[model samples]
Target: MKQSLLLITVVGLLLSSCSVSKSARGQRDLFSGTWSLDNISYENNSGNFKSVIFNDAEDICFEGSEWFFRDNNSTGRYTIAQSTLCNGGDRFFRWSVVEPSQNYSSQLQFKFIDENRKDISGGYGYRLNIVSLTEQAMTLKSNVSVDGQPVTIVYEFSKK
Candidate 1:
């Protein structure tokens, strides 16, 4: 009886570990394919707006950007359309979904890379709180401080 109980416990533990990994993998799989940044809104009404986001591009430039994700290789790229105001181009990146824990929410993180897939940020990346994700839509939030007040930038994306 004792040996049987021990085996059962071991098996249960292994299964639980696999379950966690599977969930994370599933989330990544859902991110595969192309998505368009449809909308960007602010949570707090501070009457102040940020000109740039992620220190990469203007807030207006990200809207309508095309994002492509490859789950198998964990590689992706986003392209901003060229316009009179925006200097549009393609940006390569390595991305991952960070699993949630007791103290934190799930995060979407990505680091910019060059055309050759070389890290260009000197080991720096951006992490945004994944507010919601589904097969059709995903929302991410980035918290920042503006004038010593908390602000949240919400990014909404839809699969294409």
Candidate 2:
């Protein structure tokens, strides 16, 4: 009788524990890590989409670029490493999320804060909508205007 009661209690506890769900990175703190630029794709005004090709040799300078996110901080840095394509030494610029309250997985607003390069204003910002994100990879989409035409850009990155 005691064995039966013990077995029933154990089974009950196991069944009750099964409902606890694991939180994914998208729902919680998961963006604080180094990420590398994987690739970029863009859509033209006519609703046509195409991937940007790094056909030029100098374009490879950014192929090794990185974006580092600080833990619990909405600020980050865009790091351009020194390469043969670029000899300006290593360059780092301040960047931050315009609004950290919103979900980056849904819609993320980004702004460059380095005033020397360009004027930092509320008017200039980039919007990235996360398409996919995992511990290994993440992809985001940004709608941009080029030459008065709307374009949708998809940026793919890998965690480093």
Q: What would the TM-scores of all predictions be?
A: 0.85, 0.54
> Per-residue lDDT for 7 in model 2?
100
Largest TM-score belongs to which candidate? 1
Instruction: For each candidate in the order shown, give its overall lDDT on alpha carbons.
Output: 0.89, 0.57
TM-score for candidate 2 = 0.54
Residue 86 local lDDT, model 1: 82
Per residue, candidate 2 scores C-alpha lDDT tens digits across 1-160 of 9999999999999997753223422422455688898776565656544333222224344555786765453566666666655643333233333323345545545555552544354446556676766777878777666667778766788989
Q: List candidate 2 segments past 4 Å from native.
A: 1-28, 44-61, 82-105, 114-124
Specify the highest-lDDT model's number: 1
Tens digit of per-residue lDDT, candidate 1, span 10-129:
999998875546667888988999999999888876574756877778889999999999998889999999988788999899999989989779888999888888899899999999
